[model samples]
Target: MGGVLADGDRVKAVVVKSWMASTGGLEVHYQDGLEKGSSLKANAIQQGLEEDVHVSGAQDMETVVHRPAKRSKVQLGSAPPLTDSARLLARRKHCRFWENSGDEMELELLAAVGRNLQPGTDSILLGTDSHTCNAGAFGQFATGIGNTDAGFVLGTGKALLKVPTIIRFVLDGEMPPYLLDLILQIIGEISVSGATYKSMEFVGSTVESLTMEERMTLCNMVIEAGGKNGVVPADETTFKYLEGKTSIDYEPVYSDAQARFFSDYRFDVSKLEPVVAKPHSPDNRALARECKDVKIDRVYIGSCTGGKTEDFLAAAKVFLASGKKVKVPTFLVPATQKVWMDVYSLPVPGSGGKTCSQIFEEAGYDTPASPSCGACLGGPRDTYARMNEPMACVSTTNRNFPGRMGHKEGQIYLASPYTAVASALTGYVTDPRDFLM
Candidate 1:
């Protein structure tokens, strides 16, 4: 159960027991002992499994696992490790579609897929952009590809290769209250370009402790630090989180016996406090207390990054604390239609089947709209039109570029869904920690 599942390999079998809907998709329950099923089915069953069963899926379906291949600890330094293989790999898989299209419209058209077909035509490109990694949830080896590498992939199907040195940030301890906000702040400090061309593997006691919603929040940010991909080795936590939710088999990815990493960073959850990122960048890391006075015009708490069930739950927590109407225009756009349905309609633990929209409306904010890329992609809903008026927005989207939300003059701040809710209530950049108690 702890080892990696190879492609096309069957490890065990489990019987279907029940069904549950997740942000990812429909999941099915299985008895604790069966070993073979579709990876998608496995994901669903993994979430529903109350008892253990044998499970089987493809090697590609396995979630990469991380174990310390070497015992020596390495200190953090200014420069990242140099690796030829990772660089080559990045070059080989850059975006070819954007290259083929000369204009934005063409690129958008290429992104669209037929309703019944798989969106991934072949290999996919990754971006620090939140939407870039959405393809992976659909079962593609998709990740964010940088401008340099994107150019190469666009020009040629293959980019250069330099196998990344892995750095596993394991999760063992319980996440502090509103920990999702803390993750965004940490990633903010790492910057959208920090892990450029690196493989950032998440492994630790704390990682093993998080729910799938929480882990996805972490993995979703791999591109934020410029890393090629952020992965968690499949474990009990992962399997349980994903069980009964995905048909995809839950396989684990293990590092090679000789796997090498340039450095490792560890965080003690017990010592962590709530955090927030200032406007206009996901990298503007700061203590939430330091930026409480900053006023804002909009607070958006949804996107692929922060629009999941866990995200909605976090926002609801903040709304409960504020105990009033939001002062500003706060928009909650679920990442996908499925997510919207679950949070707004589906019955689940904690939710008691109350939709997120019902919660928000009860809390005095506008009910959320249907799913879309929305602010993350500068779409129609809640876009910035005026510039230089000092409008502050706390969004769950990844990038906060000059015109990312709309007008070049509008300012955008990146944070987790919880932070957005806090700001929405206060009409300013408010820290989530103050409400935790």
Candidate 2:
């Protein structure tokens, strides 16, 4: 009823009637009407409501209604049936809903669909989740939109978007082991709102040498700095990551040699050190060592931004190297089931066949929790690992704003996986160089 009638009267009438029959009356609120009407139409076709009800769009589309008999087993396959033990463990760790979404996190969902879609080409990706910009690592135009736009995309497979001005970041030095520090430096220099409504384009030798995971981490944080999107040009590294993930034919695009930018910044990261964002803001940058005098109540390592398999491996490398148990209660939540399995199955390269889970255990840490967003979203009060009282925490999550991880009065220090693990080992905001070097 809300989308364009793409065909003759028969099809249009069926869609409109099915939507009206599914729900009584019309949705009149401007934004709600746009979304609800489009969604109802989609549901009509997807659920075969057109076959169940026979009515015409011209026949009082606002008045007719139909309600189907309730199914005996509603949402039977919506989520996996976890065992009582599994459910208990998930609750204790505050992880849930992997079965409902198929994938545990939005980043994983992007991988499943846009892994092979080339950027700079005629391809576009729109997600309801803000971090959809993460796919910019593969050189694609990806960004987040509201439910109204999402519903429109659902009804029709196209969307309208304005082109954003670009800001180029030229990174040309040997990168330090702590990648998060680089992003923190940029955010600190530009402040959170500096890139508002602009695309941040990363290039130069350092970006070219980064792994896909590292590139994704950088692009994922663009939204935190008010960026519309972030991009890293597609190269052999991007193509290699796409191999075996998708078979779709896609053409790659690149910037012109004389492409103009709203602004340009250059950084040589060879001398960088681990950094963190203090509580109440992500751009409040401070060197990890500068905050070593600050004690923490816990350490958390999870979320789409910092809970990838590679992130875990970086933490495990610190744990194995230190050969020390965590001084604080360290929590682990992998971002997806695939990453959870990898922590248990994939061996650390120099750990004599030890997996991350084993290394974590040896370092007196709990087994990696089930994969999900967990406490990073500050979900329900009963969420596992959620901070229930005022306390300090060092997390690998990208955000450190007040109440971001649960309690409004709690303090959060955002750091990279390496810095998070190192701080966990010492119960303070310790620099990763203390261990990594």
| Candidate that would win on TM-score | 2
Candidate 2's displacement at residue 117, Å, is 2.9
Candidate 1 has a TM-score of 0.63
lDDT of each: 0.55, 0.74
Candidate number with greatest lDDT: 2
How well does candidate 2 score on lDDT at residue 132?
Answer: 84
Give the TM-score comparing model 2 with the true structure, all chains together: 0.77
Across residues 127-194, which tens digit of lDDT does each residue of candidate 1 receive?
43433543332223346556787666556757765767666564457777766754565576567777
lDDT of 2: 0.74
For candidate 2, give the lDDT of residue 135: 89
Please state every model's RMSD to the true fold in angstroms. Answer: 17.3, 11.7
Error of 2 at 310 (Å): 0.8
TM-score of each: 0.63, 0.77
